[model samples]
Target: MTGGATVTGEGRTREPRDAVRARLVDVAVHLLRDRGPDAVTTRAVAAAAGVQAPTIYRLFGDKDGLLDAVAERAADDFVAAKAQAARAEAHRGADPVKDLRAAFWAQVEFGVANPEVFRLLGDPARVLRSGAAQAGRAVLQARVHRVALTGRLRVPEGRCVDMVQSAGTGVVQTLLATPVPDRDPHLVGAMWDALVAAVLVDGAGSADGSGAAEPTASATFVAFRALAPQLPGLTGAERALLVDWLARAETAAVQD
Candidate 1:
């Protein structure tokens, strides 16, 4: 008797209202992906979903509301994928750098491939307020945290996180902005190579003819900050103070 309800054999069973919303979202996602954001009109989505046009407004307020749903769904899928990849890497005891690289590649690919979704989630105000954006950051932080635990992180965790995130966003935006004919096939790998060289301590962490240096006071400070909460023999207040001091030092070092 309404939009999204299925006709059963003499039963007239109705699908749940949430199912109709999900169906509308799925249709809108396809429209956005296949035909760009302009294609995701209220009429287009409703007609495509086999629902009445008024149902769109009834279910999602307006066109903006529908777009928000699409963005939310896309973010959930993207974050879930990164989370799963991080989990699999952790479970396998794999090199975090390997996982990090993989995750970075996936992120770049996702951003470029899903320009509509990326644009929806790329707003600064939205990122600051969005729970999905925070979850994505948490996933990236976990990856960076694992790398820091390997004693190879060249910078403090917070700095490393900001650098990687900024670089990843830059790479995606740059690649997406470039013309297809002029896009470099090696740009992604080159970026990864440059980023890893900067963030990670490669070769022997020594001075015996190796380019890398021994872990310094700064390095120790970074390591301590990374593991500050778990160190034993310190009172809770002491640990908090140490963490605070280390954070200040990390910021000062960056500034210097």
Candidate 2:
């Protein structure tokens, strides 16, 4: 009624307002997935959805608003998937170590499976400035906190959630940043294994010969876990800097 042109669907000439909004979003998502975010525009979305441009604005407020909606949808879907995976792990009566590992892999798998959505949620330049991003981060942080409080992990109470959240974020960031051919699954798997191992095993002695002694991949994760508790007081940019340094150190060590 507001944005989309009326079309005959089963002999009906009237279009529901909700249907128009849904169509616009669906088209916008397809455009984003097929051709990056830059290609998604109000005009293009309207054209694709057979809706008027003003309708998109009315429904979404603005381009950024639409992007925010898209991101929220994607984030909600990902959170649900992670929760489901965790539940399945619980249902199977998984070992704590194995359950953690499975959860880490589930995050990575989702990122790889939905690269566009992953990028939308992860790009700092795009996300940090947005209210939607902050809201999404809060939701995720709460979920991480809930898991840590359950005491299934052998990590410090202060650092456990941060360690898991950062590791998962890093995995997605690495995958998105690297070239396709160079996106080695083995390397990703090793990084994940090292992070999980650090959480499950305490002290330097337990991690000896665990294949994470090398500073780049394994040691870096351990260091981050050790340092996570100090992060809450940091600014977003500061947190990014710390994580970047850790990643660089890990990369160098792994290459060595």
Candidate 3:
């Protein structure tokens, strides 16, 4: 098979194989954005990329594979923007909590601005498995670990991570569900505060808040949830069952 081919689009010719793949992914993303997911058929993408249908299959395997590539590209862009913001925050000597808040705000803005791609990223299972998504999570975990290192985290490292992810995703999904003009502009800030209050100590990592909004029962379970992976003496099935219980406890913890 040829490693490179000339692919023309918009009166420009892409020469490298990677460049051709990128063009296809970009076209697929644009179609997915403006026309919805249904519009990103193989033929549509091939036409938009000025390539034969077989090229997409050769580069990405199939339609699902192409969508995965598109999702990864979107995730990479989001992660890159967040990383740049975090770096800028560091250079300015920003507070860790403030840095976290800024990062959260960036995520909110990204999700709100790219609702279609955000929808593709909303699946927890997919996020857990995607390399790009894992990179984003690592960034978040590093921030939360910094908070933990400060002794300001009211919950375990794992619980705080989960709470933060849940709140951010919940807020974006809620806003996206509302009509554009009808959406509440302040909802993101409110949810951020609530999430901070739920995980940080009084006057701790948060700019405004005390101990958790709920009791520590939920937080303790989260700590246990984090520990489940290392608990010894349990069979594989037992460990899985315990993890499931921990998950249920985590859900209940927020309700408290």
Candidate 4:
């Protein structure tokens, strides 16, 4: 919770603070989804949640604070979902490589399915200053490092991990910006496959084996594919951070 105001009266409203906070968050999320981030405001949230605006301000310090809280909640939800999905997949005797691929795809799918939640979690300004944001990044980076060290993927000196992460962001962002009705699952799948292939094939040479070639979209795909196997090892928080980064990248690309 971001804003909390002190009460002067001995017998203030008896509403449970947690319940009120939850309601406000729910309202904010709804508004954000239906109307965009700019649509969320103290007065709007309070009215929707059936609470006073001052209560909202008190629960969350300000609009930014409320946004941060909402993002935090979304991150928590994302992590829990990923963890559950990972556990189920692991129980099914999934290959680490396959598991990582599924996880990445799941993230992208979720973002597309829930654009409002994605926007809240992916907003760069809000994420950068959030504790949830920092934790999420650290988790992903650690997973990448771990998988590389385990030799699950051919990540060299952690460079491949960085490359894969960057490429993944590009892929997800591109997906987010494209109109949903116009999006082709086959094209998205192809992009992910291409990314995986480029990263997995161990060669300094280009796809065609020509001399050192300029990095193209195909090359980036290869870089990520090489690192995909290690992605599942990342913590839920880390996965969230990675997703957020991708979302932010997509936002930037759309603006450009």
Candidate 5:
């Protein structure tokens, strides 16, 4: 009977608020994965978590809110796993383009496997404003930036990010639209190859790895843009101005 918990009939402290929240999300995620989204009603999750129905409302506002929490947790874990995998691949001298392509395929797998969360989080307006969505995009952008740093990217990083994000979403939706038995397993690889062709120069992949490359005219600006925050002898305003210039230069070079 303290700050965020209570004592049960046996004088043992009840679960902490955070632990209870995690338990609810765990149950909801299992329901989502096993029984589908429609089965994750507030009452169902509450009963699954061994809590009063009102406890769900108090913690998550409503069933929709609970779903959001579940999805957000899923998104965070997904991003973290991707990041760890990327680091491991980087150590293995993986080509940046290949790494990005692998990431794209994994993302497609995620989307298709979690149809309910995919649909819930896919709302345009919600994606625009969601922290989870933004974090996911940040991972994509970082992978693109790695490609840029390798001098393999032909387009500006930002433009490349938009294209990849749009393409991945389309691939996911198209795959999900088809019946499970009829879904095309080759769709993701074919789409990824086409996307890579559009965004990378011929002979674009690097064996020098993710560390560095002989900077192309465009990649020079891209590289500098990534380092803008860490540039010495620059005030914050100067750093901002440097990034803006680099972005403009990179965009113009790609557009030309």
Candidate 6:
């Protein structure tokens, strides 16, 4: 146990491999939080975890891999909590706009509470490739779909999703940049209100029932298209065909 010396049966370790891996991640998280990102060197994490450096490479590939795993782990936990709360709210039949606003606040709180992991999750490359990132997006999309189903969403659901995510990220980053006392207390509420106004119709549902009650046929098509992927009992090919038809319908509606 001294300097990663083995205690084992026939070269197999006494502890489970997963336990060892979790120990390394925990040590790295502590280092990143306490000493900042620069202090989370492979050598440091390995030493702190009581494992040899090669174990770090074997378990995580390299430092970047290790960081990604750590980010994913943290994000998974955060998203799971959010998803659970959202499910609970769904059972209560919460207003879509109010639910979205509450989610935004949670995002802001998470960003502030775990700045290091938040920054890691913000990396474009990491976000693009990470399953954790995809899971988070799926949760947001589900929420947006609920809004669309209520005929409250005015723009395309994807557009609304992008807007919410971008605004949340920007607001959190700006607040993080400001000194604690100097940060504006009203910024989050103001931004959320603005985004909601921009993306939602004044009334729920479109009058003709084509689009969230908007006069535009294209808007309805957009909402329909957004929900295509979620249709249960549809094969991948069937979903694609549905999406294609919706896209064509949207184009035709726009031209009219």
Best by TM-score: 1
> What is each predicted model's overall lDDT from 0 to 1?
0.82, 0.64, 0.78, 0.62, 0.81, 0.82
Tens-digit per-residue lDDT, 1-256, candidate 3: 1356554656555579888899999999999999989999999999989989999999999998898888999999888877777667667866667678777887888888888899888866668668999888888887775555455556667767778878888888998899999999899889987887677655654554333333256545655665677789999999999989877876775566
Q: Could you tell me every candidate's TM-score relative to the true structure?
A: 0.85, 0.62, 0.74, 0.64, 0.82, 0.80
User: What digit string (tens of lDDT, one per residue) describes model 4 on residues 147-232?
Assistant: 33333333342454555455555666777888878776776467656665544333222223332333433334334433544597
In the order shown, what is each candidate's alpha-carbon RMSD?
4.3, 10.4, 7.2, 11.4, 3.8, 5.4
Superior by TM-score: candidate 4 or candidate 6:
6
Candidates sorted by TM-score, descending order?
Answer: 1, 5, 6, 3, 4, 2
Clashes of 6: 5
* Candidate 6 segments whose C-alpha is farther than 4 A from its true place: 1-13, 203-256
Residue range with the least summed lDDT across 10 consecutive positions in model 3: 206-215
Candidates 5 and 6, the one with greater TM-score: 5
Q: Provide the lDDT at 46 for model 5.
A: 88
Q: Candidate 3's error at 68, in angstroms?
A: 0.4
| lDDT: worst 10-residue window of model 6 | 204-213
RMSD of 5: 3.8
How badly does each model clash, as a count of residue pairs? 0, 1, 0, 17, 0, 5
lDDT of 1 by residue, 127-239 (tens): 77678889999999998888777666778887778877877788889988999898888888888778866776664222232444356455556667889888999999999
Question: Which tens-of-lDDT digit does each residue in 135-238 have in candidate 5?
Answer: 88887887887777666677777788998888888999998899989988888878877886678765564323343334456666666777678889999999
CA error at residue 116 for candidate 1, angstroms: 2.1
Clashing pairs in model 2?
A: 216-250
lDDT of 2 by residue, 1-256 (tens): 3356475756657777787777787787888888988889999999888878999889989998787778776766666665666567656754434455556677778787778878777767667665655554554444443334333334443455567668887887788788989987786577766775655433221223233222234444545643654678888788878767755664554345
| Candidate 2 off by > 4 Å | 1-14, 123-152, 202-256
Alpha-carbon RMSD, candidate 1: 4.3
